[model samples]
Target: MILTVTLNTALDITYRTAALTPHATNRVAEVTERPGGKGINVARVLAALGHESVVTGFVGGRTGDALRELLAAEGPGGKAAHAAVSDSPVTDALVPIAGTTRRTIAVVDETTGDTTQLNEPGPTVTPAEWAAFLTSYEGLAARADAVALCGSLPPGVHVGAYAELVRLARAAGRPVLLDTSGEPLRRGIAARPDLVKPNADELAQLTGSREPLRATRDARRRGGRAVVASLGAAGLLAATPDGSWRAAPPMAVRGNPTGAGDSAVAGLLSGLVERLPWPERLARAVALSAATVLAPAAGEFDREAYADLLPRVAVTEQSSQPEQESHATRQHR
Candidate 1:
C-alpha cells in the first residue's frame, strides 16, 4: 500500500463561471468542494489507478470534519463513491488537531479556461499535535510500500518537517517521494528522498536556474536520488541514476491544471511500486498529467483520456553531453 502525508490538509472549493471580470460581481454557475492537498490529491489519483492508498495527515475543526466527510463520501459505500478502476480502497487516517483546517478556493473561468486561486493559511499546529502526527506517520510508513511527503508546512510547524519525515521513511526502508516548495523543499531534498517532483518555478527556486536540464541536475546534486521537473505543457524532464529522459503528451489538453502535478506524482509513485522502467513511468506520468487537465475538478482524471494518451506519449532519452561538458569545464577551472 502507498502512504500519502498531507500536513496542511484543506477543503478545496471550486467556483465555475462563464467569465471573471475585475471589480465586478460574478455569477457562479457551479460550485464543487473536495478534500484537497498535494498528498491527498495524489492519494485520490493512486486510488483511481487501482492502488491501495492510505492518507494520513493533520486535520481538525469544522473544515476538517467536512473534508473527511467529503473524502468518506467518495470512498467505498459512500453515496457518491464509485468502484475504483481496480477496486482498490482509499483509507483515511487523518490525525486530529485543535486548530481548524484551511480552505483553498479555485475560481474557474469557462470562457478563457483560466483559474484564479485564493488560499488561506492553514491552522497553526501545536508542538504536541506535531508529535502526535509523527507517531502516526511512523506506524503508517512501516506498512507503506512507498511514502509521499507532500505540500506545505502549516504555521508553527518546523521548516524541516519534511526533512525529518524523509529521514524517518528512509530508516523504515520505504521508498519516499518529496513534493513541496521553498525552504521545506530545500531541506527535504537534502534528506535525499528517493524522488523529488518540482515544477518549473520550484526548480528555479531550488537551483537559481531557469534552464530545466541544468536545474534538474543541480537539484539532484543537492541530495535527491532523482529529480523530475514538471514543465507544464512541455511535459516532464527527469534525471535519475538509471538515466535521463523527457516525456511529453502528443498535444496539450485544455482544462483545469490545478491537480495535474499531483496526478503526475501519483503516476510516478505507482510506477515505482510496480517496478516499471523509467521510460514507462515517465509515459504514465505524462499521460496522467495531461488527462488531469481534461477533468472538471482537481484530483480527477478522465479515464478515457488517460487510456487514449498513454500509448501516444513521447518518451525520449536525453543526452548526457551537457553534464559531461559541465564536468570537463569544472576540471579545467
Candidate 2:
C-alpha cells in the first residue's frame, strides 16, 4: 500500500469561461470540482495506474464532507460509499479538524487556455489535531511500501511539520518522498527524505540558482538523497546518488498543467515502488507529466498520451563534471 499525506486538503473547483478580461464579468460555461491538493492528486494518479493508495489529510465542515463523498463515489466498481474494492481503490483516511476545508478556484480561459487561480487559506489545525495526524501517519507509514508528504502546511501547524513527518517515516524504515516549497521545503529537506521533487521556481527559491542541475545538486546537499527538478516543458533534471540524468518530452504539449507536477510525483513513486532503474523512473515521470497536460481537467492523465509518450521521451545521462555540462554521457529514446 502507498500512503500519501496532504497536510492541507482542498475542494478544487475549475470554471471555464469563453474569455478572461481584467475587471470584467465573464459567464462561466462549465464547472468541475474534485478532491485536490498535491498529495490527493498524486494518489488519484497512482490509483489510475492500478496502485492501492490511502490518502490522509485534514478535513472539516461541509466542504470536507463533500470532498469525502466525491472520493467515496469514485471507489472501485463505482461504489457509492468509501469502501475499498479490488484493483486500485483509494481509501480515505482523512483526519477531521475544527475548521472548514478550503476551496481553490481556477478560472480557465477557453480563448487562450490560460488559468487564473484564487486560493483560499485552509482551516487552521490545532495541536490536538496535529498530534492525531502524527499518530495516524506513523501507523500508515509502517504499512506503506512508500510514503509521500506533499503540499503546504495549514495555518496553526508548525513550519517543521513536514520535517517531523519525514523523521517519523525514516524512523519506520519507509522510503519517503516530499514535494513542497519555501521554508517548509527547506526545513523538511534537512530531515533527509528519500527523494524531493521540486519545480524550477521552487528549486531556484531554495538554492538561489536558476540553473536546474546546480539547483538540484544544492537541494541534494540540503539532505535529500535524490532531487528531481521539474523544468516545465523541458522535462525533468534529476540528481541522484547513483548518477545524474535529464528526461525530456518528445514534443511540447500545451494544456492545463495544474496537476502535471503531481502526476510526475506519482510516476516517480510508482517507479520507485516497482524497483525500476533511475533512467526508467525519469522517463516515466516525464511521460506522465506530458500526459497530464493532455488531460482536459486537472488531476487527470490521458492514458493514450502516456503510452505514446513513454518510449518517445529522451533520457540522457549527464557528466558528473560541471565543465562537461553540455555533453551527454548516454542517451536513450
Candidate 3:
C-alpha cells in the first residue's frame, strides 16, 4: 500500500466566481470544501485507480475533525471512500491533533479560468507532537510499499522534516517520493529520496536554474534516483536511473489544472509498485495529470478522463546524463 504524509493539512475551500477583483467584494458562484493537502489528494486518485493508499498527517481541532469527516465522505471529495466501496469497507482514519488546523481559500475566476489562492501558515506542532508524528510514521511506513512526503510543512516544524521522513521510509525498506517546494525540497533532496516530483517553478527555485531542462538535470544529480518534473498542460519530464524521458499528453486539455501534480505522483508511485515499465509508468502519470486538469472540483480528478487519456500519452526516452555532481546551488533561504 502507498502511504501519504501531509504536515500542514487544511480545510480547502474553493469558490467559483464570474470574476474576482482585488479590494472589491464579489459573490461566489459556487463553493465547495474538503480535507485538503498534497498527500490526501494523492490517496484520492490512488483509490479511484483501484489502489489502496493510506493518508497520515498532522490534523487538529474542529477544523481537523471536519477535515477527517470530509476525508471519509462519499460522492465527489472522497478520500477513503473508494476503499470502503471497492475493497473491504473501512473508516477513514485521519489522526487528531492538539492545535486547530488551517483553511486554504481558492478563488476560481470563470472568465480567465485562473485561480487565486490564499493559504494559512497552519497550526504549530510542538516538539512532543512532532515526536508523536515520528512514531506514527514508523508504524505507517512499516506497511507502506511507497511513502509520499508531500506539501508544505506547518509552523514550528523544522524544514528538514521531509528529510527525516525520507530516512525513515528508506530504513523501512520502502521507496519514498518527495513533493515539496523551496527549502523543504532542497533539504529533503540531501537525504536522497527514491523519487521526487517537482514542477518547473519548484525545480528552478531548488536548482537556481531558470531553464527547465537544466533545472531538472541538476535536480537529478543532487539526490533523486529519478526526477519527475511536472510541466503543467505541456507534459512531464522524467529522469530515471537507467534513462530519462518526456511524456506528453495527447492534447492541451482545457480544464482545471489544480491537483494535477498530485495525480501524477499517484500515477508514478502506483506504476512503480505495480512493476510497470517506464513507458507505461510515464503514460499513466501523464494520463492521471491530464485527468486532474479535466476535474472541475479542487483536488479531484476524473477517472473516465484518466482512462481515456492513458493509452494516448506519448512516452519518448532520452539519453541518461553522464555521472556527475548536480550543479544545483540554491542561495540557502
Candidate 4:
C-alpha cells in the first residue's frame, strides 16, 4: 500500500458566496468541510485511483476526531462511501496527541472564481508526541510500497522532521516523495527523496531563479533524485535522471486550485508504482491537476473532467543543450 504522512493534519472548511467585497459582510451560499493537509489529500486521490493507501500522521482533539469521522465515512457502510467496492480504501493509522488539530478556511467567490484562504498554525507537538509519531512512521514505512512525506511541520516539531522521515523511508527501501516548503523542504531535499514536487514560487525560493528550467535543475542538484515543478495553469516541468520533459494541459482549467498540487503528487506516485513511463506519468499528473481545479472542494477531483483531459495532455521533451550553454556562459563571466 502507498503510505502518506501529514504531520499537521487539518479540517478543511470552504465557504462559497455570490461575491466577495472588501470591508463588507458577504452572504455565504454554501459550506463544505473535509479532511485535509497535503498527504491526506494525496491519499484520498490515490484511493480514488484504485490504489490501496494508508495515512499515518498526527491527529488529536475535537477537530481531529471530526476529521477522522469524515474520513471513515468515505469507507464501506458509511454515508458517502465510494461507489464501487473494487476501489481501494484509505486506512487511517494516525497517531494521537494532546494538542488540538488545526483548521483551514477557504472562501470561494463564485463570481470571480477566486479563493481566499485563511490558515491557522497547527497545534504544537510535544517531544513525547513527536517520539510516538516516529515509532509509528517506522512501522508504516516498512510495509508501504511507497511513502509520501508532505506538508508543514507543526509548532515544536523539529525543522529536520521531513529530512529524518526521508532517511527512514530510504533505509526501508521504499520509494519516497517529498512535498513541502521553506526550511523543511530544503533539508528534506538533501535527504535525496526519489522525487520532489514544488510549485513555481517554492522552486524560485529554493533556487533563487524564476526561470522554471534553471530552478528545476538547481533543485535536482541540491539532492532530489528527480524534480517536478508545478507551473500552475502551465502544467508541470519534470527533471529526472533519464531525461527532461514539459507536460501541459490542452487548456487552462478554471475553479478552486486548492489541492491541485496534491492531486498531481497522487498522479505521479500512482504512475511510479505502476511502472509507467515518465511521459505518461507527466500526462497523468497534468490531467489530474487540471481536473482538481474543476472540483468544488479540496482533496477531490472531477472524474469526468479527468477522463476527458487525460488523452489531450501534451508532453514534450526538453533539451539540456541550452541549460548547459547558459551554465558555461555564467562560469566564463
Candidate 5:
C-alpha cells in the first residue's frame, strides 16, 4: 500500500455563488464538504485510480470525527464509494490529538470561475502527540510500497518534521515523495527524498528563481533525488536522474484547480509503484492534473478526460544544459 502523511488535516468546505463582489454579501447556490489537506487529497485520487493507499497524520476533536466519518461513509465522496467500484480503497490511519482539526473554506464564483479561500491554521500538535505520530508512522512505513510526506506542519510541531519523516522513510528503504512548501519543504529537501513535487511558486521560493528549469535544477541540488515542478496550466517540468522532460496538456482547461497538484502526485506515485518509464509517468501525471481541473470537485479526475489527454500531452526531452539555453529552445517529438 502507498502511505501518505498529512501533518495538518482539514475539513474542506466549498461554497458556490453566482458572482463574488468585494464588500457585498452573496447567497450560496451550492455547498460541498469533504476531508482534505494535500495527502488526503492524494490518497483519494490514488484510491480512485485503483491504488491501495493508507493515510496517516494528526486528527482530533469533533471536526476530526467528522473527517473520519467522511472517510468511511458509504454513499459518495467516501471510502465506500471507491470500495464499491474498485478493489483498492483509501485507509485512514490518522492519529488523534488534543486539539480540534481545522476547517478551510473555498468560495467559488460560478459566473467568473474564481475561488477565494479562507484556510484556518490547523490545531496545534504537542511534542507528545508528535512522538505518538512517529511511532504510528514507523509501523505504517514498514508495510508500505511507497510513502508520500505531504502538507504543512501543524502549530507547535517543528519545521523539520517532514525532514525527519523523509529520513525515517528512507531508512526503511521505501521510495518517498515529499510535497509541501515553506520551511518544511526547505528542510525536507535536505533529507534527500526520492522525489519532491513543488509547484512553480513554491519552487521559486526554495530556489530563488522563477524560471522552471533553473529552479528545478537548484531544488535537486539541495537534495531531492529528482524534482518534478508543477507549472500550473503549462503542465509539469521534471528533472530526474533518468533525464529531464516537460509535459504539457493538449489544450487549456478551465475549472476549479484546488487539488490538481495532488492528482499529479497520485499519477506520479502510481507510475513509480508500477515501474513505468519516466516519460510515461510524466504523461500520466500531466493527464491526471488536467483531468482534475476539468472535474467538478477537488480530488476527482474525469477518466475520459485523462484518457483523451494521455497520448496528447506534449512530452519533450530537455537538454542536459538547462542553464545554457531556455526551455523554449528544446525540441519535441
Candidate 6:
C-alpha cells in the first residue's frame, strides 16, 4: 500500500468565471471543491488507478470533517481511500491554531481558459503540533510499502520538516518520494530521498540555474537518487540512478494544467512501488501529467488523456551526464 502524508490539507474551492478581472464583481459560471493538498491529490490519483492508498494528515473543524467524508472508506468515485493503519480512518483532530484549513481559490477565466489562483497562508502549526505530527509520521512510514511526504510546510512549522521525514522513511526501510518547493526541497535533498518531483521553477530554486538538466543533476548530486522535473509544455526531464529520459505528451489534445506536477508524482511513485522498470515509470509519469493538463477540474487529471498518451511517450537513457547544458526544447503538438 502507498502512504501519503499531507502537512497542510485544504478544502480546495475552484470557480470558473468568464473573463475574470481584478476587483470586479464576477459571477462564477461553475464551482467545485475537493480534498486538496499535494499529498491528497496524489492519493486521489492512486485510487483512480486502482491502487490501495492510505492518507494521514491534520484535520480540524467542519472543513476537516468534510475532508474525512470525501475520503471515506466507501466514498465517491468508488472509494479506495481511507483504510489507513489507524482505525476509523485517520484524520487526526489537530487544531489549526488560527485560520481554517487553507482555502485555495482558483479563478479560472472561462474566456481565455486561464487560471488565476489565490492561496491562503495556511494554518499555523505550533511547535507542539509539529512534534505530534512527527510521531504520526514515524508510525505511518514504518509499516508502509512506500511513503510520500508532499507539499509545503505551514507557518510555525520548521523548514526542515521534509528533511526529517526523509530520514524517518530511510530508517524504516521504505523508499521516500519528497515533493515540495523552495527551501523544503533543498533541506529534504540533504536527507537524500529516493526521488524528487520538482517542476521547472522549483528546480531553479534548488539549483539557482535556468538550465533544467543542469539543475536536475545538481539536485541529484546534492543526494537525490533521481531528479524528475516537470518541464511545462516540453514534458518531463528525469535523471535516475540508472540513467536519464524525457517523456512528453502525444500531439493531440490540450486543456487545463493545474496539479500536473502532483499527478506526475503520483504516477511515478505508484510505478516505483509496483517495481516497474525505469522507462515505464517515466512514461507513466509523463502520461499522467499530460492527463492532468487535460482534466478540467482543479487538482484533477483527465484519465482518458492518460490512456491516450501512455503509448506515445518516449523514454531514452543517456550514456553519460553532459558536461554542458543541452538546449533541446522539443514540444508535442
Select the stronger candidate by TM-score from 1 and 2: 1
Write the residue-wise lDDT of candidate 1 on 184-230 in tens digits: 99999999999999999999999988989888998999999999999
What number of clashing residue pairs does each candidate have, in the order they appear?
A: 0, 0, 0, 0, 0, 0
Best lDDT among the predictions, by candidate number: 1
Question: Is 1 or 5 the stronger prediction by TM-score?
Answer: 1
By the lDDT metric, which is better: model 3 or model 6? 3
Per-residue C-alpha lDDT of model 5 across residues 165-232, encoded as one tens digit per residue: 99999999999999999999999999999999999989999988898888898898899999999999
- Model 5 regions lying over 4 Å from their true place: 74-87, 323-333
Model 4, 55-81: lDDT tens digits are 988999999999998888776456654
Off by over 4 Å in 3: 75-93, 321-333
Lowest summed lDDT window (length 10), candidate 3:
82-91
Error of 6 at 242 (Å): 0.9
Q: Predictions ranked by lDDT, top down? A: 1, 4, 2, 5, 3, 6
Question: TM-score ranking from best to worst?
Answer: 1, 4, 2, 5, 3, 6
Which residue runs of candidate 6 sit more than 4 Å off their true CA positions?
Answer: 73-99, 321-333
Candidate 1 minimal-lDDT segment of 10 residues: 79-88
Reference-based lDDT, each prediction: 0.92, 0.90, 0.83, 0.91, 0.89, 0.78
C-alpha RMSD between model 3 and the true structure: 4.0
Model 6, CA-based lDDT: 0.78
Candidate 2 runs further than 4 Å off: 79-87, 323-333
Give me the runs in candidate 4 sitting further than 4 Å from their true place.
Answer: 21-27, 81-86
State model 4's lDDT. Answer: 0.91
TM value for model 3:
0.90
Residue pairs that clash (backbone atoms under 3 angstroms), model 3: none
TM-score of each: 0.95, 0.93, 0.90, 0.95, 0.93, 0.88
